[model samples]
Target: MTMNEANTYDRYQRQIILPDFGVGRQQKLMRAKVLVIGAGGLGCPVLQYLAAAGIGTIGIADDDLVSLSNLHRQVLFTVHDIGLNKAERALAVLEQLNPEIQYIAYPKRLTVENAFEIIGDYDMVVDGTDNFSSRYLINDACVLMKKPLVFGAVSRFEGQVTVFNYRDDAHDEPVNYRDLFPSPPRAGEISNCAEAGVLGVVPGILGVMMANEVIKGITGMGTLLNGRLLTYNACNNQVYELALQVNRDARVSMPADKKEFMEMDYDCLCGVGDKGFEIDYKTFSELVRAGDIAVIDVREAGEVPAFDKFDVVNIPLHQLSRELSQIQAGIVVTVCQSGQRSLVAAGELASAFGNSKKIYSLKGGVLQWPLLHKKELS
Candidate 1:
């Protein structure tokens, strides 16, 4: 036998010994290419095991920076990695763990402009992103690209895993994420890890399950979660499987062509509103220091770590509609916990007072405000 073959056998000996998954499956894994959409929670474990299993090429995509809070779930990053780009940090660790595989880090958020191009390069895509906008965008892109997708998500004490766009041999048509979730949930209707808080082990479990689906897609080792969704409850260790059906309306939501897809307003469509009047924390800070814009905090009365500057007014989102007359400033901007509700509030304001007042939504809200201010301190 060749020296390379001998080395590979030794490396994956444990998995290779499995009756159905021997040298053939190992080689398939070594030839597969997979792209994971986020380097946080779910992506961490997915990237780790896929690389360890010798996936030939793996892509990591994320634009967010590592924060102290992400350490609990994002196992790939260290405390020293705080402020570093998540995709790059994850790539560095995975490369160290398995130098044999090709690791590419796209340190940018996946947008319509880049999603198609980036996803096209991979054999399959894995959805580990937290928000519905990104999740829907990835799912649509994968469907358009005709790429298989290994999907997983975690919230609070529960997680779900499934494989989408898998063409079952027994079936005439393929199933995708849209088949399961026909439309993106209304913004703020579902809580993300940041808002709801997931147990650290939850993503670890779901992520490993996602990795298994990817391996199955590559090596055809077992039945992929093509037409099924598996839900796991960490609190009770209970597992449930639900069969999925093809949704005709779901496919209709996808863009008809690449140009249309690139021009799609995913954020607004998913109910997070638009970036048209969104202001970044840094720019908003500058405006605040200059002192003219109306800074409306749309969080509830008791939200912590309050902002004391910018002549901020406290009006919860639920009350913003009735309290519009209370705001005295001309250029109004809304802020919320993590930006979603604020965007919704901004949209409402725009609809109510179209050209009469300039409206803007804080891009990353209170969660990102401190980070932006810290940069000024530095």
Candidate 2:
């Protein structure tokens, strides 16, 4: 390491002073590589602390943009970052916090194709991703590579944390993500934060826990939750840790190859595909500009103050099933008051139409639709 590198260790003085994590363990932290998969609710705190802890290299992968709604929980971005890419905003802040460590930003959505590529470079994968598809993809990829994943997920006020697919490959037994939830919950079965609501600090607690797990795993100290699940109920201030065992039925044979890691259709894998799917407004604009896809509005009729210029059919959610076939084998845009209905309807379309057709969920529904969406249809 160069002279500038020598000073990197000095930045972690506060943490270095902690018992068992003196200069020696601190050095390990400085040399460790960590990847945080999302920059949302759980991710903000996870990345924030990891950077501050002096992790040598950190990478963040998120394709979603910051929104007013996200600002309430994803503390990393502010109002000014409303439309900026999440990974970009997180990287900007993280870099400033600790220029001592190298920070990389994967501003694209984490997909099966790029999941491992994005995570394999790192030693620990901090899962802040909300959707099951991403979770399975990340877990599957990590298991295949024998990488340790610090997983944290929050639903409403309840949160779950676990360390799966650690370095210990004794008997080649890998505790896969399926061990937690054997099957993906149907789309819209559980209310997402945007629909149901979550306390601002819920993900923060879970995220910080994940960051702690990463730190412990890197330094090889503390009891890591390798085959256990830790659940926290902030509303009740109750915490529980339960041991986990590999499921014989779901003990996915250690992936046969790396291609398996990239082949999962998170759309279908996470049940999001079943509800249709989401594409960024920018991407929707691109597809519309190309003049190939049809946009559909699933919002309730008269539910919103209409100012749309997009050539979309106002097929209300209640009427979606009847008019389903009306939509061609083209990209469908689902719109709602904020976005919940559209997400639900989108999944409906995907399940029936299969993956050949494209479906996109408008962020924040029509509430945040960009002016370009109107300009294109007009």
Candidate 3:
């Protein structure tokens, strides 16, 4: 054997020895190209294994920065990586894990304008994002491009994994994410990892599972999770598999063509838009400066770098319901450390005050303000 061939075998000798997965499957893995969205909790493990398994070319797309809080689950980063872009940081580490493969980092958020372009180059896509807007956008892009997609999500102690837009030899029809949930959930209808909190191991387990599906899809070895959703509860160690049926009507809700898809506002459709009372830092600043607005910090007491620029009341989200009488302003803005809880607080205020008060959640929260609007801060 040539030195190159010997080296390649040495790297993947373990799996290659399996009864079904041999040198041929390893070569298939080396030839596959996969794109993973969101380099956070689930993305970290997924990227690691895929790289170690020698996927020929892998793309990492994420616009978020690594925070100290992410170290607990996003094992790909360290304290030194704080404030660095997640996609870029993940690429650096993944390259070290397996230098033989190619790694591409798109250090930007995947939007309607770029989703199609970025996703079109890859043979498969993996959804590891935490929000509904990103999930729907990625799903629609894969559906439009006819690329297979592996989806995973975590909440608190439980998580779910499924494969979409993939047809096995036995199945004539393929199912996408929308077939499982025809429409996006309303704002505040579901809480993310930040709002609900999660055990680090939950995503670790689900991410590895996602990588398994990707391998299965490429090598055609094991049975893929096509048309099936698997749910796992970390606390009780319980697992359940639900058969997913293709909803023919689900495609009606998606964009009809690339033009319509590009024009679609996933944020608005997924309830992260103005309809949900989510405002950027600039808008929040304007509202605060306009006066007659009650700025309520929904973060728990003792949260650092407090918002002292203006007079604000400290009302934790859990206590907001009991203290609704305390807020007497016509316009209310809720603030939190990372913006997740503030959205929930805004939803609560909307329900309590109805049309009487204009409730808003500061998007990106306090931590993101300085990074997004440095000039405004100065």
Candidate 4:
């Protein structure tokens, strides 16, 4: 046997010995190209396994930096990687794990303008992102490119997996993500791992499962997850599979052309942008100390420990229009648990009082307040 063949045999002997996967399956894996978005929790396992499986070209797309909190779930990184770009750090570590594979690191956020270009080069895309904006964007882009997407999401103790835009041999029609979630959820209506707290193993399990789908897609090893949604509950180790059908209405939401898709505002669609003026916690803290602006907590009354220092008013978002008289100040700031509700409140206040009155939403809200205080202390 040739030296290269002998080396390849030594590398994948166990997998090669399997009746279903042999030299041909390994060759298919070696020729496959997959792009994984988000180098956080789910991305770690997906990258590790795909690299070890010898995917010919793997792309890592993420604009975020590693933080202290990510160490628990983002296994590809370490304490030393904190503050570094996730994609670059992930590339560095994966290369050490398997130098035979080719890795591309995109140290920038995926935007509509760039999504098509980057994703067009890959055979399939993996959705490891945690947010709706990124998820929808990747899904729409895959549909536009006619590429398959392996999607996985984790929340607290529950995780979900599905394959979108994939054509199965049994079905002539391909199923895309839009068929599952026709529209994005309203901002603050749903909380992420950062807000709700996810079990460390949830993303790990979901990510590995997502990687398996990708392998199946590349090698045609097993039944693909097309048209099926797999949901797993780590708390009880129970799993559920729901059959998904294409939605004509959902298909209409996709951008008609490349130009339109490129110009689509995913953030706005997801209710994740500043509709009104926004102020950082540091600046809001300064305003609070100076007693220049009134702080209005828009969260429901029973939400949390009340704000003690600044004479803040607890006006739930629903009552803001009726209780406008309670807030006497011309300049006001609206705040919520995580800054999302506050944005909505700020917009309402701005619209009600007109442009003459200044309104600002506390960016990052009460959740970020303590972090800012800690930074000040440090």
lDDT leader? 3
Model 1: per-residue Cα lDDT at residue 188? 48
Instruction: Give the TM-score of each candidate.
Output: 0.76, 0.73, 0.82, 0.79
Top of the candidates by TM-score: 3
The weakest ten consecutive residues by lDDT in model 2 span 1-10
In model 1, state the lDDT of residue 318: 71
Which of 2 and 3 is the better model by lDDT? 3
Residue pairs clashing in model 4 are none
Model 1, which residues run further than 4 Å from truth? Answer: 1-5, 274-378
- For model 1, what is the alpha-carbon lDDT of residue 94? 88
* Pairwise TM-score winner, candidates 1 and 2: 1
Q: How should the candidates be ordered by lDDT, best one leading?
A: 3, 4, 1, 2
* Clash pairs detected, candidate 2: 112-262, 133-270, 274-347, 275-346, 275-347, 276-346, 276-347
Q: Per-residue CA lDDT of candidate 2, range 330-355, in tens?
A: 77777777878778777677776777
- How many residue pairs of model 3 clash at the backbone? 0
Q: Residue by residue across 1-378, what tens digits does model 1's lDDT show? A: 321667767888999899999888888888778999999999999999999988989999999999999999899999999999999999989888988779999999999999988998999999999888898888888878888888999889999998888776765577887788788765545657765578999999999999989998899887888878999999999999998888898888888778888889889888765457688876776666665578888898989768664467999877888998987777888888888778778777887887988888888787777655745633
Ordered from best to worst TM-score, the candidate numbers read 3, 4, 1, 2
Better model by lDDT, 1 or 2? 1
